[model samples]
Target: MTVESAILLLPWIALVALDRRALAGDVELSTLIEPIAARPVPGEYRTSIAYYRAVLALRAKDARSARALLDAVPRPLPRKRHAEAFEYLGALLDVVEGATERTLASAAAHEHGPRRASWLAVRAHAQAASGDVESARATLRMLRALRDPQLDLASVARWELPASRLASELMRGEEHPFR
Candidate 1:
């Protein structure tokens, strides 16, 4: 492999190693975020770090803090990271703040992207939260068609799986009467 290819491959290999280790035991979200946030990277990468921290905050049930962090995310995120950030942020808004309509709108706006499945999944949760069962089911049907496995492992291990699973259940007909 060329030097450039080798350089790119190393990050992926490290991420895979981290994923395996995370699966073996509990991985702290803050532990993952702090290091990334401390070093100055490109603005685009910093936006992703901020978004991940927001996801961690939401997972910790701190909606207020999550919103604050999310608000600080720089606009016009790098093209490569934009869709995933939007999907996760929308889901967090739906779950934490109960802003179903806004979340759904945000998710729907990104439907044409590579992260469509993730956006659909978040939209499904938003619809379910809004008591729109039919819409949620339709969104899930779309997601099933795409079959994106990354949806299951999108965020840090401590939060991503549980949050996505909860969102899936909410979409799959479990009535959340409490909003």
Candidate 2:
């Protein structure tokens, strides 16, 4: 490729690299939020920025902010993302909005294939929250059984680590402190 061609591809290449870093849990959203928000980007890129911002908000334990950021992400995200917006939106509503027995039931009853682990982890937490520790343990065991080394770290960092910690607490006979 010519130098001009390489220059033209630079932006795309940088975006992809940033995505990889985001997935690897190597990059934090706060660090990227400013530069991304400073410029006007569109479509999938915009969706990605909103996704990261939501993650940051969630990490700070601010569900309301995460919900707001998630609202900015357009529906039916372009299929390249790890967690679909619809699915996460459902989980977010369950975990942050209503999160009652009805919410847990809805989340548990849903058919989430590729996203099963994430969904299940949330469901388990819901179970624990509702004081059904046994059911929560079972659900978390199911999540642990589904663990695969090949799954991307981004998803793991976003959900699994917390689930694992909860599971560990369950095993040690302590009530899971997570909300």
Candidate 3:
């Protein structure tokens, strides 16, 4: 791979490693992310690295850190899809950090392709966060009905990973929404 592409992979690899450790309940996710956070991000990879770090911070329930990291990602990322992903991550953070109406509205506007399931997940999370358990459950049903295996962190398109992970977390609760 080219140097630029290679540089981008660092955060993805660290994220994957964090995911594994998180699943195993073996170590503090923050600890696993420290080394990565300590490194100087390359200019070409700055936005992508910030995005990944935001994802990691969100996973660790560190919304303040996630917000700062995400805010550091420059507008109009290198690719259109990357910009879209940034928007979605921002919406997800809205849900997590308390701003359901806006997030729900954002999620409502998307209804096709990889975005469909991912937005549905955001909708569900927003509903759950807003104390609308019934609506959240229904939204989860719609997301589940999609039955798209790609709507999972392990196999999802890179941009959709956060939403997929959110969906899985909501699904895992089965009898309820969120942990």
lDDT of 1 by residue, 88-172 (tens): 6656566557777777778768789776766776776677667776666566666666656655323222344223444455445
Better of 2 and 3 by lDDT: 3
Candidate 1 ranges beyond 4 A from true positions: 1-27, 78-80, 152-179
lDDT of 3 by residue, 80-133 (tens): 656776777788789877899999889888866557876776777788778876
In angstroms, give how far residue 67 of model 2 lies from its true place. Answer: 0.9
The candidate with the higher TM-score, 1 or 3, is 3
**Most accurate candidate by TM-score:** 3
TM-score of each: 0.62, 0.65, 0.66
On residues 40-83, what C-alpha lDDT tens digit does candidate 2 reach at each position? 56566666667667766666778788788776666666764534
Model 1 scores worst on lDDT over the 10 consecutive residues at 153-162
Better of 2 and 3 by TM-score: 3
Off by over 4 Å in 3: 1-44, 152-179
Worst 10 residues of 3 by lDDT: 153-162
lDDT of each: 0.57, 0.57, 0.62
